[model samples]
Target: MSQPDNPLYKTETASYRERWIGFIHGLQDRICAALEDLDGQALFRTDEWEREHGGGGKTRVLSGGRVFEKGGVNSSVVWGKVTDTMRTQLKIDGKNWFACGLSLVIHPVNPYVPTTHGNWRYFELYDDSGNVSDRWMGGGADLTPYYLFREDARHFHRSFKDAMDAFDTGWYPKYKQWCDEYFANKHRGNEMRGIGGVFYDHLRPADSADADRLFSFQQANGNAFLPAYLPIVEKRAVMPYGERELEWQEIRRGRYVEFNLIHDRGTLFGLKTNGRTESILMSLPPRARWEYDYQPEEGSPEAVLLDACQHPKDWVK
Candidate 1:
C-alpha cells in the first residue's frame, strides 16, 4: 500500500475521499457514544496509532462493562504502494493504493444478547503515473446470537432491509443471500456464523451519477446499525444469566474465533498487509472455549442456534 499522491488525484476523487474518511470517523464517534450510554458503566479507551509504512488509525475498545463484555469500534485511513500479493488478491495491477474503512464488533455480557459485526470501506488503485485505475465501495452488517430469538433476529434484519429498500427494492434479497453465503464456515458442512444481515463488496458505480447515490446508500445502511442492533441489545442485556449460560457463550465464541482466524478475508488482508494486530483481532471475543466435539443436549438453546447457523431462515418474510 502507498500514500495518496495528492498532486495526481482528480478533484472529484478527493471530494469522495474526504467524504468517506469523515463519514467513518463520525460513525466511530457516534457508535462509541451510543454504546457507552447503553452500557452505563464503562467508557471506551482510545488508542491512536500510526502505521509504520503509511497512515494511522484510531482504535477504541470497551471492556468489562455491565452490558457489553468487550467490544471495539475502529476507523482507519491508510495508503501505500501495492505489493505483488495484494495485486494477486485484489486481481488488479497498480503501484499505489488508498483505502479507508470502519470496522466494529461487539460482544455482550448476556448470552441472550447476540454478538454483531459490521464494516464499510472504500478502495482505490493507482497506476505508476498516480492516475486512479479502479475504485469500489463495500460494506454490510450481520448478527450472531448464542441463544436464538426470532423477534430479535427479525428486528435486526428488518432495520437493514428497510434501509436498503429505500435505495433499491431488489437489493435486500440479493445482499441478504450474499451475506449468508459470504459469512459461512464451509468446512463445517456450510454452517453460518450468524442469522445473516446484508453483505456486499466491490460495488463499483455504474456511472458518475451513481457514485453519489452509492455514497448515500452507504450512509443509509451505516446509519441503520444502531436501530438494527441496539434495540436487541437493550432488551437482552438486562436478561439474567449464570455460569452455564456464560459457558455456552464462550463455547460459541470459539466458533467465532475459528471463522475470523481461518476464514475471514478482512483478518487475512490485515495480517498479510502489515495491519495492527491488536486492532484487527479486536473482533475476537474477550473469552472463547473449544471442547472435543462438544455437543449441546438435544433441544437446548445452544442447539437451536447451531440449527439456525446450519439452515439459515428468512427472518423478514
Candidate 2:
C-alpha cells in the first residue's frame, strides 16, 4: 500500500522502529539462553551478517544437542529501495522500504517434542522524502507436532489465547483460523502442517496510541512462546520412542518441508527479496523423507495424527 500523496503521513514518527528492534534483539538473547539451558549440551553459534543491498541480521543455530536436533533463532533489520519485483510480487509501492523481525524454528531430537515456529515483524514504506507513507505489524507462533498430544495442543493454543485475550478476546480465534489456513499443504488435499496456533498479519495501527497497543500485543505473543512450548518439551523430551516413531516423525517432517518451501509466504518473500539463503531456509528440519503413497493403519497413533492434520480441531473452548 502507498500513500505518498497524503501529506498527513509525514507527521507520523518512526520511533517505534527502534523500540521493536531492541525488543527482538533482547528476545533473541533470552530465547537462546533458555534453549541452551534446556539442551544442556549444545550452544548456539552466532553469525552476524550484512545484506549487500541494505541492512543485515544476526543468525544463531544449534545442532547435535541433548534435546534439540536442529534449531535456529534469527533477528534481522533490512532496508532497501522499492524495486519492480517487489511491486509486482509483494504489490506494495514505496520509494524505500524497511522491515525488522525475529523468526525461529525449533526441532527436537525426540519425536514427541513438537517442532515450533514463531515470528514477529514490523514493516514501513517510506515516501520519496523518507517520510512514512504506510506501516504495519505482523506475525504469530504455531506448533507442528510429529505425534498428536491433545494436551500439548491445548496448552500451546491457550497460552497464546491468554496473551491475546488480554488485548482482544476475539483475536485468538481469528488468528487460530488464519494459522490453520495459512500453514497448509493445499496441493495435498488441504492437510494442515500441524494442529495449529495463532497467526495474524497486515495489522496497521490507526494512530500512535494504537501503534503502542499493537506493539504490546506483539510482545505479549513473543513472551508467550516459551511458556507455550517449553513445558510441553519438558513433558515429552524424555518419553521413550522407537524406530517406528522416529520413522513417522521423519515422514511428517517431509510435509513440514513441503509447506515451507512451497506455500510459506515468509520464506518466499525472503528469497524473492534477496534475503540470506541460509537464514531464510533454516526452518527446514535436519532430516526428512517422502515415502510414495504413504498411509497409516486404521485406528493407529499415526492415523490419529493424520486425522487431526486433515481436520483441524478447536484446542481451546
Candidate 3:
C-alpha cells in the first residue's frame, strides 16, 4: 500500500504546523474522492459556515450511497476564549485558547462490516499577553462493526498494529485495550462497540525525542486508514444481504446511537462548546430502530454475531 507521494512533505520553508494542515487537507480530499468513486453515486454535500465567535469549518457529508448509508468528513480551525466550565472539565488554567483539527466519521451501509470514527486535533493556550502558555495534541481512531467479519477484523487490527509497532511494540495492545474500554456502554454492563482500534489523547511534547516519537505515531496511524478499511469495504460491498441482516443492523444501530449520545465524551464536548449540530451528530447511523428487549433466536448466525459484538475477540491471532 504505497501512498502517492505527499507534496506537503517536500515543502522546505513551511512550519510544522502549516505542513500538518496541508497534509490533512490533502488527505481529506483524497478520502472523499475515493469514497465517491467507490460509491458510484455522488452523495456528498459540502457545507461551510462561520462560528458565532470567530472561525469556522468545512463539512462534507455523504448519504444514500450504494455502500455507505451516511458519512461525514469535517475540518474546523476554531479559536475562542475557554469558559470557566471548560477549564474545569479539561482541568487547565486558561482564559483564551486556539484549537484546530480535522475529524471524520464513516458509517457503511452493510451490516456485516463495522462503522468507524476518528479525529486528530491540536490545541493551544495563550496568555492574556498573547504568549504561548500550554499546548497538546489529541485524537485516535476506533472501529464499530455491527456484524463480525473475521478476516476484515484481522486486517484492520493488523494495519493498526503495524502502525503502533513502529512507535513501540507495547503501544498496539495497550491502546487497543484502551479503545475497547473507552467505547463501552457502561449502562449495558460495559458492552463494547466493536473489537477495538488504537486510541490515545492529551499528548504533549516532551523533549525532542518524545516530541518526534509522538509525531511519528500520529503520522503512522493517520496513514494506516486506507489499508485498515478499504479492503474490508471492497470485500463486503458486493456480498448478498437479506432482510434479517438489515433488521439486525438497525437494532444494533440503536445501541450505537445510545453510546454516542449518552456516553461519548467527544460528543459531550462538542455540544457543550456550541460545535456544529449537524457535524457533531453525523456520527449517527443513517437508519436505526429500537425494539424492547428484542433478541435474535438462539443458535442463529445473527445471534452469534450479536454476541461477538458484545464480547470482542483476538482478531489478529
Candidate 4:
C-alpha cells in the first residue's frame, strides 16, 4: 500500500492539550473501524460508570470472530485525588489529577500473524491551590506474533524506526530495545512478548527548546501505527493453516496471558489506580491453553520460533 500523502502531524495550537485528546479519539475510531472491516466483527462497547472511582469510560470489545480472536479499544477520562503511591511513582507532591487517555489491544485469530497494542495519554496534576503542577506524556505500540515472520517483522520495525529517525536517530534503537526488555517475562528468564516495537513513558520537555522536538517525535510515532502493523496483518491473515498451527497459537497465547496478567505495568497500574476493570483486563486473549511443562520438540518449526522469541532479532538493519 502506498503511504498517505497527507500524514498526521502534530500542530502547535493555543489549545495543544485539547488537540491531543481529539487526536486520540480520532485514532480510536479509525483503528476500531479498520479492525471491524477487516475482521467482519462489530465491537461491543459498554458505557459503565466506575463506582469505585466516580468516573466513567467506554469499553469496546470484540471476541469469537472470524478474524479477531479478541480485541479491545477503550478510553477513560478520570479525575480524583492522586494516591500516595502515584505521587511517589510520579515524583510529585500530593494533588488532584485530571487524567485522560486511550488504550487498545488487538488479538487476531490466525497464528501466523501478530497481535498488536497501542496507547497514548495526556495527564494533568493540580496542586492544593488548584494550579497545574505536573503534566506529561506516555504510551507506545507493540507487536506479539505467535509465529515468526522475519520480513513482516522487519517491515513493522522499519516503518516505526523511520518515523522515529525522522525526529531523532537515537530514538528507534533505544526504544526498540526498551520495548524488548520491557515486555520480557522475567520469571521465564526474559522471554520477550514478541518482536520488539517502540515503547516509552514519562516523557517531558527537557527545556523550552526541546518541547517542539518531543511533540514531533510523539506525533511521528503515533502516525506510524498503520504503516507499521496493518501491512503485516494483511499479508499473513490469509495464509492457510491447519489445526496443529491453531493449537500452537492457543498455547503461545497462554504465554501472552501470563505476561499481561503478571508482568505488564499497564495492567497493574490500571488495576491499582481504580481504572475500569473490564477495559483494563480486555487485553487478555479470548482463548488460551496451558500445559504442565510443555515444550515443543527440538528442531520443529514451533521450537525454532520459540528460540527466536527467547532471543529477539535485529529486524531493522
Which model scores highest in lDDT?
Answer: 2
- List ranges where model 3 is wrong by over 4 Å: 1-14
lDDT by residue for model 3 over 1-317, one digit each (tens)?
01112212222312555756666677678778887888897568989877775567889999988888888888776666778767777566655565667788888887776788877776666666555567677777877776676787889989989988877899788888788888888998788766677777778877657755776777778778877888888888887888988888888788889999999877887776778898889888878998998888998876777677678677789
- Full candidate order by TM-score, most accurate first: 1, 2, 3, 4
Global lDDT scores for all candidate models: 0.89, 0.92, 0.76, 0.76
- Stretches of candidate 2 off by over 4 Å are 1-12
lDDT of 1 by residue, 32-86 (tens): 9999999999999999999876787999999999999999999998777788888
Distance from true location, Cα of 215 in model 3, Å: 2.5
Clashes in predicted model 2: 0
Worst 10 residues of 3 by lDDT: 1-10
Candidate 4 per-residue C-alpha lDDT over 75-148 given as tens digits, one digit per residue, 9 for 90 to 100: 77666667887766645564666556788888887888888988777666666765656667777888888778
lDDT of 2 at 169: 85
As for lDDT, the candidate ahead, 1 or 4, is 1
For candidate 2, give the lDDT. Answer: 0.92
- Model 1 scores worst on lDDT over the 10 consecutive residues at 1-10
